[model samples]
Target: MKLPVLSLLVLVASCATPGGDAPATPAEMAAQARTALVHVEQPDPGSPLLQVDTAAIADSVDDAKARALLAPLLSQIADLSLARTHVSVASADWLLQCQSLRRLDVRACSRVDDAFVRAIVALPQLEELILARTATTDASIDALLASASLKRVWMWKSAVTPAGLARLAARDGLLVDAGLRPSDSSAEVEPKPEFVNLLPMPGEPALDAALVPINVNCPVTGAPVDAKRTRTVNGRVVGFCCNNCPKTFDADPAKYEAALPKP
Candidate 1:
């Protein structure tokens, strides 16, 4: 996704005029970036699986005007409630730019720890924080308590203990959701079917579907057909008197494929 070019134009226009405050922290840099985001005329980049970071722009542009101009394109940012994005301690600094942020979902993020929790606590406007299935523990729960605006915190499947929950319960206004729930989208996904080989532990039999049976019989053992012991190969059903016969037949089906009754 491209950064706001118009903001850059504005930065260029402001260059000849001189002095302004330089950003110090990631959040400060992100604040400068927000101005650019506001002026961006292009389409939304959408939630990209791989994020393009703005570190290079912040590093290369030593000019205060140029750095201020480019901050919005370089910092990792989300304007609204950032949900379901892969956030961890490493990239959590990106959220510093989202001054309007209210909700954050870092579920299933293995790297989420006290550092990430502390970083977000500084956001004065943050409200809902979802850390289900993440690695957060009691170490950062106190930091969360510091946010006067926070209303709800979801901590299911995290490292928090009952004691931690008890401590949070003392707070007057906060609501915590500690019940077990799936971490991703609300949709229920069905499990895929599994197949097992019938042969004994040592070998895998490669069966050929080309052989057509002439009669109903366990071609490998010459035994009468048993409906319970059947397998389909190449769209045709083959049966055997015992379950094991199918394995032997499968080992070298061509030897017996012609022996069964043909279609």
Candidate 2:
């Protein structure tokens, strides 16, 4: 897949102007680079940090290359931010190093998981976290509470379960947005599927016509697929929003044999 651009959502906002709360000289502003970080590299003497970053990122077409491009960024940056950058597990481990970090927002980053969530709890300075519309879950919230220093957590339309919310509510000091439910889209019009039994994971968007709804659910957590959001591959087959889902069914067709709809 083509890589997306990096933004400052999870990192410090841009340096302000020098004189009017800003500096007229670009060099002066750059001096405050401590406040934020860009994916561009900075080395001594006309170094090619920028060139390397761009070039490496361009190689994201190969997953391994994408991983290599993201490796340098983690530990060195004091204020690492890659909001909506669609980070993977490796990148999350890198972000754990921003010792001075105060805010981390991975909003709309689709591939988040328990490991990344657990990693962020170690950031003592993290006061505000935004995981809106991501794959966050109840376990993630539990980890967030363990941080002790966290004051607010904004996670709208995520997978924060009712049990998870109750667990945290018992402890005061959390400003949570964990009540939202997934698959709550009451179709403005009734759906047209003949027989439906499963659905996609929350917030994972449909891709091309082939993959209207992605199924990231595990066996224990699977939900019914909504026909309105699904497209037929063959009369007996369907597609997923991401390459990651459909793993189990692919492994043993016989295991899910009975679950398949009749042709």
lDDT of 1 by residue, 121-177 (tens): 777667888788777889978998888978899888889998897787679899888
Segments of candidate 2 deviating more than 4 angstroms: 1-80, 179-263
Q: Pick out the ten consecutive residues of candidate 2 with the lowest summed lDDT.
A: 9-18
Q: Residues 113-193, candidate 2, lDDT per residue (tens digit)?
A: 667788777876777777777787877866888887787777777787768767766668878765455667675876685
User: How far in Å is the alpha carbon of 14 misplaced in model 2?
Assistant: 24
RMSD, one per candidate, in order: 14.3, 23.0
TM-score of 2: 0.42
Candidate with best lDDT = 1
